[model samples]
Target chain A: MSLVFAGACSHAPGITGRSERADPKLREEFYRNLGRIRECLEAARPDALIVVAAEHFANFFMDNMPAYCMGMSDEYEGPIEDEEWLAIKRRKIPGNPDLSKRIICDVMQKIDLAYAEEWKFDHGIMVPLHFLTPRYDLPVVPVNINCQGPPLSPLHRAYELGRTLRAACDAQPERIALLGTGGMSHWPCTPDSGKINVPWDKAFLDSFIHNRREDLISYTDEEIFADAGQGGFEIRTFLTVAGATEGSTGELLFYAPIPVYAVGCTVATMAVE
Target chain B: MSLYCIQKLLYQLNRDPYTRQRYHDNFESLLEEYELTKEELGAIREGDIGLLYVMGVNGQILMHYSALIGQEWDEYIHAMKEGVKSHGPVRAGIYTLLKGSES
Candidate 1:
C-alpha cells in the first residue's frame, strides 16, 4: 500500500505567483511553507499523487453539473499567464484508471456515492502542484468536489469518502501520496478581506494535523461555514485529507495566515498506521 | 414556490432594497436583458436567490438596478482570476452567477 500524506492548503492567486513585487513577508512565508512541503514530498517519494480539491467553475456548469467529479485523464494543466491565465493548458499525467475504477466502484457500491468522469484540474489542484511539484513531472489523479453548489457532501460523507480512497490506494500496488488543498480562513474581495480568524483557524489546523477526526467530524456545516466565510469552500480539502488518512494520525508541518490574499495557508503530513 | 425560487428570493434580499424595488417595477425589461422568462421572474419576485444565482444574472445587473433605484453599489469584484489559469473552457452559467454575485 502507498503512503497518503494529506493536509489543507490555500489557493489564493498572489501566493501562487513568483512576482518579486509581492509582499516580502508573505512571500517569505510562502517560500518557507513551500520548502517544508518539498521536504515532505522528498521523504514520501510517492509514485503517484491522488489530489483532492474543490472545483471553481473549471469544468461543470448549469447545463450539466456533477456533485462530484474525478479526473481519469493522463495529464493535467496548471494555471495560465501567457493567455491571461485563461489560456493555461493542462499537461498529461499518468492516471491509474484501474485504481480509479476500483475507487469509483467501491465508493458507489459501499456508500451510494457516484462521480462524474473526465474531470479537469483547477487552482485547487494546481496550487499544490505548483508548490509540491513545480516541475510538473509527477503523475497525479485528480478528484474534484462541487463545493460552490448546494447538496454539498456532509462532512461525515467526505470523511467516509477519504477512508474509502485510502482503501482504494491500499488496493493498488504502487505507493501513493494524497494532497488536499484549500483554506483555513479569510474572505475574498470584501471590506473584511485579509481578516484572519487566527484562533479558529489555528484550532482547525491543530485538529487536522493531530488527526482529531471525531472532533473534526463533530463540526456542523454551519459552524465551518461561520468560521471559514465564503472562502470556506476550502474545508472540502480537509475532508479529502481526512479520508486519505483514515484511522491514521497527522502532524502539523506549518501554518501561516497571508493577509495579502486573505487566506490562512497551512500544510500537514499524515502518517497512517 | 420551489426551493430554487426561495433561494433566489433570499439572494434578492441580500441585495440592496432599492434594487429590489426597481426589479419589481421594471421586471420585464430587466428579465429581457438577462434573457429570463416569466417563470424566472416569478422565481425572483418570490425571493429565490439560489435560482437567480443559478440563472447567471450578473451582480452588475443588481448594481445597475441599485443605481436606478438610488442605492449604493459599494461592493467590488475581488479579481480572483489574478493568478489562476484554466485548463479548458469552463462552463458559463455557474461561473457567471458566482462571478456576478456577492458572497
Candidate 2:
C-alpha cells in the first residue's frame, strides 16, 4: 500500500501551551480546520502516521545533529517540556519499529539518513499529535530535519528526502499517512516571537499548495531570515511534504496569523498521487 | 565560542532527569561540567534569561530552559527583549548572521 493521507500544518508550542491567549474566534476556526483534516486522516485509515517535524533540540543537539533522522523504536515519549508549560501530558507513544526500519532502509538507499532507536517528542510532534491524534492510537514514525541548527541540508535535499519517503512508503504493505508540521513565517522564542510575515507565508503556501517544486526550493537561507525570521527555516518540513506529493496540488484548509501562537496557524492537506 | 557548550548544558538540563537532578542538587558542580565562559557561567548561575539570549543561545533551546526555570511565556519574551536592550543585540549564532548581513 502507498500513502493513504498526505498533509502539513504548523506545530508551534503556543498552539497548545498558550491556547487561551489567542483570539477565541480565530483559534476555533484554526482548530475546526485541524479537525477537518483529522477527519480526512481517519477516513484514510492509515496503519502508521509519519510526522516530519523540526524538533527544537529535544533529542538531537548540535553535538551530533544528523541532517535528517527517522525514529526506529517500539516506544516513544513526547512533549518534553514541563507539563504545564506545553499543556500536554507526557505519555509513552507507540511506534512500529518494523515499519520504521523498512522505511528507513528504503529511504537510505537513495539518500544518506540517520535512524534513532530513542526519540523524545518536543512540541514539534506533540503539539500536532494533540490535535490530530488526540486518542494517540496510531503508530507514529517521526522524522526530524535539522531546521534548528545552521548548515541545514539544502532545500532540494529536503525535497529529495520527501520523494524517497514516498517511494519507501509505497513499497511497504501498510498504509501510511505523512504530515509535515512547522511554522510558515514567524519568529519564535526570541523577543520577536510574535512577529509574523503574512505575505511571505501566503506566497510560500501558494507555491506549496500548488506543488511548485522549483519555486519551493529556490529560497535562500539569507532571504528566509531577512523576511521570515529564523523560525522560517522550518520550511524544509513543508518542502519535504511538497516533494512527496510532487505534481499533486494541496488544499489550504486554514491559515491565520495568531501572534500569541507565534505562527501563521496553518492546516493543509496534499493529494497523494 | 563556548556557545555550543552553553547550549549543550541547557539541552541536557531541559531533557535529562539526571542532569536536572544534578542541576538541583549541586548546581555549582553541574555547571563545572561544561566548558562555559565566565559570562556563560554567570548567565546560567543567575538564571538570567536575557543575558543568555544576548550571548547567542538559540531560542528553541533557550525557550525550554526558560520554561524549566519557571519563566512564563510573556516573561521569556520580555527577557529576550531585555537581553537585546542591555547587551546590545545577540553577539553570535543565527541572530548575528542575520543582523550582520547587509540585508
- Candidate with top TM-score is 2
- How close to the true structure is residue B57 of candidate 2, measured as C-alpha lDDT? 93
> Local distance difference test, per candidate?
0.59, 0.92
* Weakest lDDT window of 10 consecutive positions for candidate 1 chain A: A80-89
Chain A TM-score from candidate 2: 0.99
**lDDT for position A204 in model 2:** 98
lDDT of 1 by residue, B50-103 (tens): 234334433312222223333322322221121112222222332333443333
Candidate 1 deviant stretches above 4 angstroms: A17-22, A80-94, A189-191, B1-34, B37-103
Off by over 4 Å in 2: none
Residue A184 error, candidate 1, Å: 2.1
**Model 1 TM-score, all chains together:** 0.70
Q: How many Å off is the CA of B91 in candidate 2?
A: 0.5
